[model samples]
Target chain A: MSDPLLKVDNLHVEFKTGSIITRAVNGVTFELNEQENIGIVGESGSGKSVTATSILQLIPSPPAKVANGAIYFKGKNLLKLSSKEMRKIRGNEISMIFQDPSTSLNPVFTVGNQLIETIRAHKKVSKKQAKQKAISLLDLVGIPAPDKRIDMYPHEFSGGMRQRVMIAIALACDPEVLIADEPTTALDVTVQAQILNLMKELQERLGMSIIMITHDLGVVWETCDKLLVMYAGRVVESASVKDLYQQPLHPYTWGLLDSQISEGQNSAEPLASIPGSPPDLSYEIKGCPFVERCPYAQDICYQETPQLNETIQGHAVACHFQTSEHQLERKEREYSDGDAT
Target chain B: MMETLLEVNGLKKHFPVSNPIPFKKSTQSVKAVDGVNFDVYQGETLGIVGESGCGKSTMARLVNQLIKPTDGSVIFKKQNLIDMPAEKLRQMRQKIQMVFQDPYASLDPRLKVGELIAEPLVIHQIGDRTSQKQRVEELLEIVGLNKRYADRYPHEFSGGQRQRINIARALTLNPELVICDEPVSALDVSVQAQVINLLNKLQQDFKLTYIFISHDLNVVRYMCDRIAVMYLGRIVEIGTFEEIYANPQHPYTKALFSAIPKESPFEEKERIILKGTVPSPLNPPSGCHFHERCPVAIDICKTKEPKMITKEKIHQTSCHLAD
Candidate 1:
């Protein structure tokens, strides 16, 4: 097979203030193939966003740095590239949409102006040509009456419309990769569905690899072909969406799946929640980062750190346990016990 | 039959939109909680689900009398809270407590956890300082927090811990009805589940009735016994959890449910993508508020509003095409 579209190997990101250094992304490795959608699912402070930002070389120096990593895009190392070279690749190749659409957009400028600026920034085009392209992009993103609406400022649009505008800007330069960080988190469920569907349609039509960074597992199930479950700056589980959901290996993944209040869950049963919060990232850890919150944690769990190992074809897990049956048995017992309570 | 703890009757709150020219009486207003009515039973949770600006938060505020309504009556324990004097309402506030979203913003940074929790007790004059302090410690323990955390300030705690502090503060007065307005929306998924389980447990222990408001349908289903689906400041459907989930009659409710992300990638969900965003409340539709976007809307829907039609003993819906 040809090389993957983007490969992140042994990525580590850190932020330092004074003498304190917070390890945000620790040894995150994944591969995104052409036209394949990959989801990095994790809770807050899980470093999913940091990993995505570092791929585009957006992390600032001094306070924040990519301590180690090799991000290979088309067989070129993004980390080794200078700022000037990276700027050329930033919007022209890899574009990102942020969590909050309102703040990401410039309130003072019209949507057309911003899109045209991005188009002109990457390509050698006339202002009129860029404006026409911006209008077409807006139409492609499902914005109604792009010709008139494009002149309106960001505030004139609703949350969902503004998000579409953000997507239009990200796709302005026809980037090969689109990194969306919690794109639909701020919108309502209906609007979220709209945005997710739009992304799926755009990916298939444009044939570009998408890196979706979101906390919602349902979203991953809907849009992504593969997923990486991160906890405490490390991927606890990685597999195709079907394999991971059917038989998750890691304890953290079990906790996350159990905690979701699905249709089967009745009001009488207490939600099976992970007992404790994530560990602080500023300090150093000896063993597994999830040991503090793992329900089946044993002495070995706290004493030894588990590396990501492929247990099945294309399914990797970072845990001491090799079999998923053990995790399933434990999860069922916990659920039944919760029901009894 | 379950006893009604609180009743909301024809509640309406309209904020006047200021005219561009000064000193001109504004003719337009945003009908935030227009003609909303629901009842809270003695010990049950009633979930209100709606999108932002659909007035779920505004309705919560109106129920507690935090913001006065333009026209309506809030009957709490057979007494009208709207007409009650300030002193009497202050006395009545002990029975009705609220847990707000954004745990970080709801709490005061300068105050200790113990002092913050005890502030409700002190204001209500429920107990002496010594008893209040003891009650604060007990409440902290009840919410699954370390008793020693009482001395620390709000900034010291994580999001989940701070929310626990908020719950403790709300329970300090031993409220009969706790209105949680998107309590877990601000936290992470795992922490959100923890808070939800805590809320459920507290309800059983205290026999508390909760007016839970959230946009997350799954959380609403897991927490509430009865559900009310709201749209454009009005309830489109109200029914038992089983009824609402099993057979959603309202077009809006069905659309909302269909919009939820599928359980798995293998399950093919037919999503009903609404054509446009919710209409502006300032200039709401003339007839049925949802007619503009309703897929099954008819000719009469644009000229005439639909009243709440009782489908079953406990199930009601407001839609022209539901029948």
Candidate 2:
């Protein structure tokens, strides 16, 4: 494969106030290749968003601080860059689409004004030229009558349309990497499907990598090539979509995969819910964050933390037993299940 | 023999729309829930699933009597709740309870968890303070929450725990019928599973009937014994979970099933992409409301609304092309 487009190495982000310190992103390390769609799946406070924002240096600093890490985009350390240098990369080289489109777009200005301003900020262009570019961007994202719609305010657009506008602005610069944080979580299923398909099409046409941060496992399967599972501000598992779904090694990953109730997979038996809530991030986590809820947790699970270890060619699991005898047990069980069926 | 626990017929709740432009006299109403009909069998979970503007939630509120329906007859236990006296209706409310979508908003922040749960019993005069405290502790235990949490506040608990508290509160009067309005939608997938499992266990342990309302197709299928598909305030289809999932007749139901993001990568499923958004309820298309977005809509769909007709035993559909 070509050289990875983005590399996040040993990244740690913390939010501190007075004596309390919440380590939001703890030692998150991953690589995203060009033209690859990477999915970050985690519950709230799992530090998925923190990890993304850290790459862009977008975290508000009074409470949030990048304690340690190196984020290399095209062989340049983003953490070492000055504010002026970071601004050059923010929207031009990398753009982010937030969860709520209604709140993200400026309500006071027309869509045209905002889009034109973003284009002009990145490159030298006359107001008329920027306007034309903005209209084209709108048309590119599949909004009909771009000229008429561009002049309309954000409120005039529906939830799905506003999201289309958000995508239009994000793609105006033709950024190399697009980070979408729960882009369709707020939309209806049909609308969400449209947005996901739109993003898929845009990524293919534009040749940009996508980092999709969401809690939905189903979404990851539909859009992403690689999956990163986060738990309690830590990377718990990483693998290709097929590998991770087929053989999820981490106990937390197992619980998550088993718990979902998609169409046609109705089980009369109650779902296997991961017991207990996520660990509090304000204090230091002594051992595995998921140990409290993991049914397969051993004594070592509570005593020490496990690093992400590759058991197969591409699958990496963060668990003690996963690297040991658990694999044998799982194979035996699968064989028995296969035989019975 | 199945006994009907609750029955609703021709239920409607329309709110008059306000025109954005001044002096544009608005005669239109946002038909939030229009002419919905369903029967909840005793001890069976009935799910109402639909996206926004479909009126699944308004149906829940109407059943709970939280808001009076514009027109309909709601009969529970062989009594017409609509025409019931105020005192009689208040007494009947104790048998039916509702758990709201947002736990944070449903609960009074100032009240303690114990007080919050006991509020129902207190309003009904079920027991004295000492007995109520004991009952509250039992409720917390029933929902798999720490008994010590009775003294704690709602804010102290996480989203899952807060939902537990909300469930505990709903059961204070030992409500026979519990209407769950997206109880776990606000929670994470992991936490949602816990809550859903808890609801299932509680249903069996208490012999309670549930009117589970949610937009998540999976959750509805998992939780409900029978599923009702709503579209623009109408029951487009109703059937047993097996009947609906295995054989959904309505065009909207099929599209909804296809729209769900599938998890299995090995299975190559064909997705039916429904064009356009759900039209506004304010100016909904005449005849069949879903015709505008239906993939298989025909000419007849534009002129006349199909009545809910039985296609099989315990299966009903309202689509011209259902046959």
Among all candidates shown, the one with the greatest lDDT: 1
Worst lDDT run of 10 residues, candidate 1 chain B, spans B120-129
TM-score of predicted chain B versus true chain B for each candidate: 0.98, 0.96
Task: Give the runs in model 1 whose Cα sits over 4 Å from its true position.
Answer: A323-341
Best by TM-score: 1
Error of 1 at A132 (Å): 0.4
| Colliding pairs, model 2 | none
Over 4 Å off, model 2: A262-267, A324-341, B19-26
Cα deviation at B98, candidate 1, in Å, is 0.4
lDDT of 1 by residue, A1-341 (tens): 89998999999999999999999989999999999899999889999998998999778877898899899999999999998999999988999999999899999999999999999999999999999999999999999999999999999999999999999999998889999999999999999999999999998899888999999988999999999999888998999999998988888888888888888687788777777678889999778999887767789888898899888899999988764443334556233211111
Give interface RMSD for all predictions.
Answer: 3.4, 6.5
Alpha-carbon TM-score of each model against the true structure: 0.97, 0.95
Interface root-mean-square deviation of model 2 in angstroms is 6.5
TM-score of chain A of 1: 0.95
TM-score of chain B, candidate 2?
Answer: 0.96
